[model samples]
Target: MTAAQFRTVQQPLDPTAAVGEIALFDAGGNPLDLSGGGQKITSVKATALAAGTAPTATLANGVLTIGIPAGAKGAPGTAGVGVKSISLTKDTDGNITGGTVTKTDNSTTAITVTTA
Candidate 1:
């Protein structure tokens, strides 16, 4: 091909409008197809790595896999102090008379509810 045969060109591609399709090429400069018979992602897999390990990703034979380090279970969660359960005292008519909020550390707080 002569230099005169090659000229710079620019065109807007509207992917959503099905205006154009991307061209694919192989390592040897051979053109590839993007149809069902062409190379495509066939599988995906993820694995959790060690706590101190770094995250990584890889693609091979149409398979894409990712490896992410499992976060350190977060210091055993610091023994949550949030409410564990709420025991309510109800009347015969199913009215809430009073209640107690029990926390995760076995601490309790009495709750007085007024109904109209």
Candidate 2:
């Protein structure tokens, strides 16, 4: 849901009923100068996302792209389910030595790789 908010600036009226054109009163029974009929509003929100499959996005240059990458398309056929989770063992280093990936059938796949 997108919405806009504006801060309301209002002044209280006087205690006595001696007014003519809805006199503007402040908190201390003072008149207010609302000559400027323009109110300062927050920011207006953008619209919702377009209709389509989910996509990857990137935020840069004061713009948010919530769709497929530029000039990039989906590959043919469906992707096979594999590697739901991976647990890698590191030797005092942040290099990816090897990891285990879980499949959709609750089975784990041992993955061994050398990083140099």
Candidate 3:
């Protein structure tokens, strides 16, 4: 008696489901990690300063003055020609209340200050 042989069959590919939430890619087109506990993202509003076209202020005579709108309170005034160390005093609210400026070098230095 001769035994019957069974033929092997190939399965058909299913193409019904669609992909959800496409993965993010970097500038080099590489997949980025989107898992939890990854890098923290902080967003700042789009301001004039953030744009690259903003005009920068000029530094004159070793002084860098920032351009703030009028009626705005300016920063604390600084004294002394050469300041090296700064002393700070904190208030009850944990804010800096006072500060003292000291000269960078000793007064006995050979460098003389000539007043014009």
Query: Which lDDT tens digits does candidate 3 get at residues 29-56?
Result: 4554435655422321221333333222
Residue 20, candidate 1: Cα error in Å is 21
Q: Which pairs of residues collide in candidate 1?
A: none
lDDT of all predictions: 0.62, 0.47, 0.39
Q: In model 1, what lDDT does residue 93 have?
A: 93
Per-residue CA lDDT of model 2 for 1-116, tens digit only, reads 11122222556656597432333333454544435652322322233444464333322333333343234455799767865677887767666777788888678888899645
Over 1-116, each residue of candidate 1 has an lDDT whose tens digit, in order, gives 00011111357877779563333344454554436674465765777889987555554677645666787775555555898999999999998899999998899999999867
List TM-score per model, in order. Answer: 0.36, 0.27, 0.21
Candidate 1 accuracy as lDDT? 0.62
State the lDDT at 43 in candidate 1.
69
Indicate the worst ten consecutive residues by lDDT in candidate 3: 1-10
